[model samples]
Target: MRILVTGGAGFIGSHLTDAFLSRGDEVAVLDDLSTGRPGRLDPRVAVHQVSVTDAAALAAVVDAVRPELICHLAAQIDVRASVEDPAADARTNVIGTINVLEAARAGGARVLFASTGGALYGMDAAIPSAEDQFPEPEAPYGTAKYCAEQYIGLANRLHGTAHSVLRLGNVYGPRQDPAGEAGVVAIFCGKVSRGEQPVIYGDGGQTRDYVHVGDVADAFLAAADAPRPGVWNIGTGAETSILTLADVIGQVSGRPVEPGFGPARPGELRRSALDVTRAAGELGWKAATSLEEGVASVYAWVLAGEPDR
Candidate 1:
């Protein structure tokens, strides 16, 4: 199969590109190099330095590649940044997704969108939120993702296409940028390596479903192989709190971490997890890496000078 991965030089996208290539599939990458580094990608893969927001360039690349499947992972992923400038976030997350879908239609390609499970649900949502729950996003980032999913659904209905959406949990693993607002695991690992105390915001009790990058790649593979279009939550179906995560990191690093407490950030979710039962049943996919094991990988990667590959 020929596959095209948007934002393929970034953390999760690079890992997913590896998964597809290992299986003997042809892969190409489309990235703008804003936050994505070319060094993260394989030398053999042809990378088009194009942003998804640029419709003409993106369409030209899509038409040239003519991929059978497109894994759309490009987006403005910062929550705080989205709060500051929603139009910019919408231009990338919302309008950018529309461009991908439109380009996919022209090339007769199927799309697999990387949606957000952590940000999609509201503060009052169930512990393990299901796919059927109403999305009450607190920030523009999440709202933009949900709005993009709507376009995907509309395309499927109007064109009778089988594009799928994967509502991803808080993904973290090697190659993740520690400076990013998200990817708490990577940030914590970096701080631990530097002997800097990890800061806890809002009592350190807020929780999230931190899925590993490798497992997330497997979920994409499973979704690609499936013969239908649908929404699936890719997560561990369990919640891990910030304080507990720090404990796990400490254990992994073989050091006792005394975290510094600070005032909680406003508009943050207190608890969040995804009910991945549907993905397990339909896509036959489940997160296999334990939090301790994943955190250890990130720590090792950070210690290794944070190599892109």
Candidate 2:
């Protein structure tokens, strides 16, 4: 199949691109490299340095590729940045996704959208959020992602476009940029490896679901192959606090990570985890990598000079 992966140079998207290529699919990567590093992408993949918000350019690429599958991963992916600049977030996440959907509809391609579970559900959804739960998003980032999900739903309903929206948890692994807003695991591991103290906002008790990038790539592949279009959570259905996560990273990196607590970020959620039963049942996907194992793998990757681990 011919596939077009938006944001294909990014952390998760790059891995997904590799997975698709490994399966012998012809893959075209469309990425602006704003936050994603071009060097991280494989040289064999056909890459276009373009932003998703450029509708004309995006449509032209889609027309040229005529992809059977469109894995849409491009977005403005920072909750804090969303708070600071809501318009930019909306333009990228919401408008950019619309452009992708339009291009998919025009090209007669299926879409696999990478949505966010941590941001979409906000603070209170359930211990493990089910797909049916209404998103009480507290930040513009979440709201924009939810908006994109809704637009995809509409495209599926109105245009007969097969689509799957994977609401992802905090995905971390090799090639994940430590500087990104959602890359807590990478940040902790990077700092610990440098023998620097990792700072924790909000007393280090905030909990999150940390899924491995490999598992996330698998889920996307499964979603692309599913017979029906739907939404699914891609997570381990487990929660780990920041404090515990820091300790785990410290242990993995062979460093002492004494976290210094500070005031929580303005729109940070205290706890968030996803219920992945639907994903397992529908997509036959589960996060096989444990938190400790995932952290250790990431630490090892960093130590190995960012090999394709």
Query: Model 2: per-residue lDDT, tens digit, 1-309?
Result: 899999998889899988988998889899998877767777888889999999999999999989999999998888899999999999999999999999988889999999999988877688899999989998999999999999998988898877889999999999986655669888878778777888898988789999999999999999988999999999989999999998898777777689887888987899999999999999889999998899998888777776643
Please report how far candidate 1 places residue 206 from its true position, in Å: 0.5
Best by lDDT: 1
* Backbone clashes in model 2: 0
Off by over 4 Å in 1: none
| Weakest lDDT window of 10 consecutive positions for candidate 2 | 300-309
Segments in model 2 whose C-alpha atoms lie over 4 Å from true places: 307-309
Model 1 worst lDDT run, 10 consecutive residues: 262-271
- Which residue pairs in candidate 1 collide? 202-264
Q: Summarize candidate 1's per-residue lDDT along 1-309 as a digit string, tens digits.
A: 999999999989999999999999999999998999989888989999999999999999999999999999999998889989999999999999999999999999999999999999988898899999999998889999999999999999999999999999999999998877778899999998999998888888899999999999999999999999999999999999999999999999988788999898655688889999999999999899999889999999999999998
TM-score of each: 0.99, 0.97
